[model samples]
Target: MRQQLRRQAGAHSDHLQDVLAVQERELKRRFEAAHEDRLRAERHKFQAELAVVMGELKGVRDAITARADLDRAAHHAQEMWVACQGLKQAIRTGQLGAASWQQQLKPLRDEVAAIRQVAGEANRFVESVLTSLPEEVLERGVYTEDALRERFCKVERLCKRVNMIDDEGGSLFKYALSYLQSLLVVDAFERLPGKEQRDESISPKLNTYEIIARARYCVDKDDLLQAVRYMSLLQGEPRLVASDWVRDTRLMLEARQAADALLAHAAATGLQAL
Candidate 1:
């Protein structure tokens, strides 16, 4: 009976140890699962915060880029304005040469190729100014009021002898007459009323007399732009005769316009920057 009681006690002890071991394993598994869940939550929170920070940084980068672009455009605009002023001064003083004038405009052609749309338009205008105008005209053909009157006097004297002809040129007869007329370069004589019946204004029709008279009127007013407009209506020999005048007029007008365009665009850019 003593031996049987020892065996029962030993078996009970073994079963109790096995039950404790099972309970410890189950508790460890549950604790490990809870710890894993906490770690996952922390990782997700960190990722969310990182994403928000990255988004903010990206926005800052974009704003900085835009600000930089605006500043660059403004700089180019300022350069263009200065160059245009130089051109206008050259037009007035006739002191600046084509080399210096074109040097001032070089930036627009080479460096500011990627400038804004408005600046690009200004560049195009400047380029046109260069082509439409001759460098020689910048030094010469600076018209004053007195010069206008004297020039118109000569022009009027010539237009007075004009008559309509269907020929492309002033006709072969008129050409011969021109040679003969050149010999009569004696405007020093007193004029009669019949000789004074010159073209005072453009008449009802579009003819050589009207064109020359109207063009002269505009030229007399020192309005080269208007003068060129009327003069452009000429064809054949008249167009050829007035070609130099037209070119000079185009230069003056184009220079002013180019300067105005660049300055205006620059002013607008400065306003936006402010």
Candidate 2:
């Protein structure tokens, strides 16, 4: 009878052990599933945030990509500025992540690094274009392209003031001829290329009004060299008035060219060639 009791107790013990083992396995499985679910949620969030950040980064990329033409750089400055702002926001968002969160984002390490590198390159390019100059490339410093344009306008206005008080003094007969010439300038005296549009009513040579208009048109067309050429044709006070402006415009052009080379290099090298 005692032997029978011992066997029964042993059998019951084994059964209990088996049940406990099965329960432990079930508990482990549940815990694992919970952990995986949590991880998946976190991954989804990271992916969403990463997508937004990448979109912002791509905006900057697109603008730079569209900047293949050097003259178009000035045109796209505002676009670049806006994209850079978006990138700045994205970087700040990334930096706001906690240390523990950063570890959780380990899978995104490469992507985050890539964003940082591109952002760094973009910032350098934008600063170089908007405020700084490649003195090594251009051998000179310059104002921002926008500032150069503003300066030119102010200088043009100052030069035009010379016309408002024009005093071409000469003999009475010469003055009479000049008055007749003035009358001939009922409209601006334009010596445009292609063919002569001259008539009795139009002056054969460019008047001050025509010179200013032509130079302005050249500038509008991003033809700084031609603008300078037009301005150089001025005589007397207008020439003196425009001399400094012309010099600065030339400098701006050189600096702009240097910036263009830098931009092209950056583009050619996948925008990583800062």
**lDDT of candidate model 2 versus the reference:** 0.56
**What pairs collide in candidate 2?**
none
lDDT of 2 by residue, 171-269 (tens): 666545544654555344434554322211333277676776677766666666777777877776667778877876665565445435444544544
RMSD of 2: 20.7
Global lDDT of each model? 0.56, 0.56
State which candidate has the highest TM-score. 1
- Residue-wise lDDT of candidate 1 within 162-242, one digit each (tens)? 332223656678866755554454242223233222234424355555566566555645666666676676655556555
TM-score list, all predictions: 0.57, 0.34
TM-score of 1: 0.57
Q: What is the lDDT of residue 201 in candidate 2?
A: 31
